[model samples]
Target: MKVTKEEVAYIAKLSNLMLTPEQAEKQAEEFSNILNHFDTINQENLTGIEMYSFEDEPLRLRKDEAIPFKNSDELYANTKSMQETAIKIPKVVE
Candidate 1:
């Protein structure tokens, strides 16, 4: 799983990346380490692990209830601009 400088250059060329020699060497080492780590993980045995769809406990949700509030007419009475039941703003497009 060791990435060579030539391989790194090839990959960079395929990806349309322009890397300096030093950067290509560094990236090659990084990519090699990542591949090695993935290979190590793939060798692990997890036979009885349960797949989690969510956290252990179920989530608690608030009840849907409508609450009364002050009327919109009184709220918008002090505003300079308003429409039938909404705030009005100046048109930006011609």
Candidate 2:
């Protein structure tokens, strides 16, 4: 469960992040602690526990419907970034 600084650095690179050495160390400690917490949960005894089921009552999902909103102009007017009808977002993919 010991997350190394190298692993954190690799993950940061994959995520397009530029983290300092201090930040990477802090992230490594945080990740290791999270893994340790999961390890503690896995060690719990769960014998003779009746598993909960939803067979008695089936969930009913409502039909999806599109309702037109009238105040969209006010919402779109607040943002300066726009590309025709859609909002212009910054490209993040490397």
Candidate 3:
């Protein structure tokens, strides 16, 4: 799983990156090392290992509480322009 400089350059181009020749070489070597590590992981024996499983009982989740902000009135009061409940802003886009 050796990564080449050309492949690194291609990846850089796809990711909108401008890598120097040295940087490309370094990245290629680093990527190759990463692939080698993956290859090493693939060669491991985990036949006796059990997969993760959730409990039979339903998962308990915290209630989604809505805490009201008290300073909303003060925020709107400081604004010069407000439409109804929301603060008004000038449109910048066409």
Who wins the TM-score comparison?
A: 2
- In model 3, which regions exceed 4 Å deviation? 44-94
List candidate 1 segments past 4 Å from native. 44-94
Candidate 3, 44-74: lDDT as tens digits: 8989887865667777899999988889888
TM-score of candidate 1 on Cα atoms, chains taken together: 0.43
Better of 1 and 3 by lDDT: 3
TM-score of 3: 0.45
Candidate 2, TM-score vs. the true structure?
Answer: 0.63
**Candidate 2: worst-modelled 10 consecutive residues by lDDT:** 83-92
TM-score comparison, 2 vs 3, better candidate: 2
* Cα displacement (Å) at residue 49, model 2: 7.3
What ordering of candidates by TM-score runs from best to worst? 2, 3, 1
Pairs that collide, model 2: none
Q: How accurate locally, in lDDT, is each candidate? A: 0.87, 0.90, 0.90
